[model samples]
Target chain A: MAALNIEQIALDIASPLAEEPGALLPILHALQEHFAYIPTEVVPGVAQLLNLSRAEVHGVISFYDWFQAEPSGASTLYICRAESCQAMGSAAVEAAAKQHLGIDYHQTSDDGRITLQPIYCLGNCACSPAVMLDEKLYSRVSAESLVAMLDNLPERES
Target chain B: MSVRVYVPSDSTALSLGADDIARGLGEIDLDIEIIRNGSRGLCWLEPLLEIDSPEGRLGFANVTAKELSTLFSDGVPGSAHPRCLGLTEELPYLKQQRRLTSARIGLMKPCSLDDYRAQGGFTGLTKALEMSCEEIVACVTDSGLRGRGGAAFPTGIKWQTVLSAEGDKKYIVCNADEGDSGTYVDRLIMECDPYTLIEGIIIASLAVNADEGYIYCRAEYPLALERLQQAIELATDAGYLKHFKLQVRKAAGAYICGEETSLLESLEGKRGQVRFRPPLPAIEGLFGKPTVVNNVISLASIPGILAGGAASYQAYGSGRSRGTLTVQLAGNIKRGGLVEVPFGLSLRQLLEDFGGGTASGRPIKAVQAGGPLGAYIPPALFDTPLDYEAFKAIGAMVGHGGLVVFDDSADLGQMARFAMEFCAVESCGKCTPCRIGSVRGVEVIDRIHQGEQVEENRILLRDLCQTMIDGSLCALGGMAPFPVLSVMEHFPDEL
Candidate 1:
């Protein structure tokens, strides 16, 4: 990751959306997309631009599971833990992944290779126990397949 | 002429490696035109590749990368193949369906406005352009379209309220925050037939006198979000959306956000907390103004209702549950996918005829209708017809019309525990019963499972459920007990 001037980046992102209704989400989304996480330093800049309290911005950011405070691992794996997936033994799949990765949900590997998160549904109930690595969705994902997929991913450091 | 090979780009199909199939076919030098369409909802047979034959779209199931070369070599759709499933409509699972709202889903290019118009797409909006707001609301009221997002409140009535409400800047917000498990129909439509939803939103905007709109799609559905953004851009550029300004907002993960008030709060860039309902959304919503918040399906169905006319749409369904229900078959079911049909169908027909029973080849022990909040109906009540009133009569809701099948291998006790856990995890903490009672419900179920004062815990569980039902502000707490109590009532042995 490049060394970013937080003030400049936040201004560039938040300036355009300043006039829009409920501009906080868009500003946050832009920051998250560009940096992969919302840095604490950008909070004051966003709050100043949007004229919202830093606490309000923080509240919004913290409420959403999508918004992260720290930079995530190179790859994020979202495993559906909802009812349909649960029915098709996703619990077992999740258990196996946690065991293999040696990390629980919402936690990253020590090497910062992967971040595991629990999703409610992937809207792929027919193909139960669905998994998503970033944008790509994989269904019928058993623990073995997920582990293999993780192993093959290009190694990266946080 | 090149053969038109339709491959589903729907999430379920994509999850099953449909992208690989599409890419592999594109790389080949074959004279085949690949059309990425939505899933026909026959999930077991996906990635269901269809060839536009003279007879109709001939179907092939589970087409993998290895089979692609063989499929092309054997004259493709022209020759007989082992994997071929004959005509797409002839498949008993699809043939029995009455796909009105989903008519153009699997047949057209999802993002192309031209393709959408070619398939009777914006006819409703055109008709709506001519009609008065009251007339439009009346047409929908006559059509009897209800909220497909769990609550079966009449959409037309809601629209009428929003239309009549005195607000200078009313809003039409489409709830695409499809957090329900075993439900993919909304996502499918938004991805496969986005124009329908866009057109429906336009019609809704026109009907409610709301010029500005926002589609609150969840962040989990990247593909759906992408497709919708594309569709909106094209529609905007083409001047098809001149009447209304539309924008898609990504909903940060919150199950309570699916609730209208919570969704409005989230839209305002606040924590998705449930709001008190004396000032209903129709009167004062979305920035403290009158808002018409409709589900994706409820809005998507508007175009169909308008194009076909209210009487024609009203003619299809049974009783007050007018219009077809897009029932999602999921979980352990064999043919799990979207099944759009009139509301008169029985659970037996949905489970046995459409679902092909349990995927495990074991007898189905239980089925959870609606969603996680729905009751776990025992196999004995398979004959129960799929109607809002009928389902309500049996202490169940046809919530979002998602049915998850469970064979004998499933433990109802675990499912009951999960229902409580889901509520606890997703609750907005607005009310005590939902926030605290869900935790207590899980503890009681766990205690019962551990054989520690089982009868006493069961009684305590029932009492807690009643309190939650009575005390909770929203359906999250109120309906959490349905699954628990149903599991206890029907499958006490499993519990």
Candidate 2:
């Protein structure tokens, strides 16, 4: 993928949402959806469009864990590490995940194939030990199944 | 007559490969009409395939793509297959319970407004349109409906405050940020029966006379967000939403944002920090205007109260907790799924009878009620009635009605440490007790577990928890101690 100018894309995203009340979050969402992270160069443009200070825009970005300042890896897998999953031995599953990928939570793989992150819950508590890859949620996820999935992932971001 | 088969598109069912089963069924040469419906909340029974048999809706559990071909080789509902679960309702896990808020979930096609109507969906809103705002509020108040989002505050009183509050720009906000570890009814309702929620929201708008409403759903639930957006459009195009303008707001990752005030802040595009209470949201909220903030269950229960009237809905349950509680059985349980029952059922019944014991075939040791913040009820207290007041008396909460069962293998000390760790990670960092105390808590538990200054650390942990209980701004800090204290009190040896 070609790296487009962040300013133009930010303007296009922020301009339309600027008129709406509480448009900052929506604009942030759109930007993240487009670029997979909020580019630092577009902060000023977002601030200007929303009639806010650069500090305010940056604060919002930094406050939300979902808003990444840096680009993510090829694929992201959010493993549930909350109370429910813990009861069903997510600790073991998490350990397996770390061992298999050789990466901790919030860390991307050396090959840039995956980024492991901790999610509180996926509401699939019945199945327990849930994991979300992109938009789809998988329940009762064993380390074996997860490894099989990791093995099939693309090598790097295009 | 044409044969119809129902399969759940609920994320839980999907995760268990319901899509593959559905696709395999479609590829078969049989003349079957497949309808993707919402989960019946019987999650352990997913991919719970149902076919409209002449007798009833015959059900099957754990049906795989390969099983789909063999199971349906005869091309009918009850073909004497090993997977057949007889009538769906006859299954004890699904039957022997009350379903009020989710009455129409698995029975109808999720996005079909027509199917929603056929199942008595818009009756509540229609009734609300006929009655005065005071009348609607009176009905809800009399029904004894409380917020199912852990707090258990009366829903009618909140709505009444919003109604009487003098704000020209009053708003109704649905707290769909279901961050609780074992809770998913809100997402289920929004995904399966979106119209019911839409109808309920419309009723709330009519009752409060608020022209605008927002459903602040978490970003984790993409399908729910998509379905609600579609439902809003459909309801609008159908003229059911003419009275109110409803929009869905996607919330970024923050467990604290599930708190009403924190949710308001996040909705306004700010950091999700809990606001100090004086002017409650009912009096002054949401852009400095009076707002009615309610859980998805609270709002969804409105239509039922409106349609059935207060007295009928009030008949279920015991003590102060009225109406049916949508108890989610999760974690290491065997038949884990959604079970909506009256408030007075025993935890033993839920855990043993409906849940069908542990998945690992080990004896059950502990069960965490009411999400991550709830207490760990020991086996000795399993016989306790599942009531808010009853659980409260025992130092537990029915928080969001999520019960995560743990087998004997679980380490109670590790669980205690995890509660603090979760609080440390998710704390908004606005207050001292929650922000600083949580980190200290993890260290204290670690010391206790390591037998380093065990007695002294135990005393220190008790005092620290008390300080957090009294000084913290919200439940995140206040109730984080519940699990730790309970495990310490009930299962002292483990800790």
User: What alpha-carbon RMSD in Å does predicted model 1 have with respect to the real structure?
Assistant: 1.6
Q: Over the stretch B1-495, how does candidate 2's per-residue lDDT look in tens digits?
A: 668889899889998898998899889888889989988988887888898887889898888888776777776647376778889988877778898998888998899989998999888887888999999999999999999888999999999999999987989999999999989999899989988888888888888899998999999999999999998998899898776889999999999999999998988888899999987989988888999999998888889889998998999999999989999998999988888998999999999899999998999999999998999998999989988899999999998999999999999889999999999999999999999999999999998998999999999999999999999999999999999999899999967
Error of 2 at B410 (Å): 0.4
lDDT of 1 by residue, B1-495 (tens): 988998898887887878899999998787889998877878888898999888889898998877788788756655276778889889887887999998887887789777888898889888988999899999999998989998989999999999989998999999999999999999999989999999899999888889899999999999999999998999999998887899999988888899999999988878899999889999999999999999999999999899889999999877778889999999988888889999989999998998889887899988898888999998788888989998888888899999988888888889999999999999998799999999998898889899999889889999999999999999999999999889888888856
**Pairs clashing within candidate 2:** B370-B399
**Cα lDDT of model 2 by residue, A92-119, tens digit:** 8888889998889999888777788899
TM-score of chain A of each: 0.93, 0.93
Each candidate's interface RMSD = 1.0, 0.8
Model 2: how far residue B316 lies from native, Å:
0.8
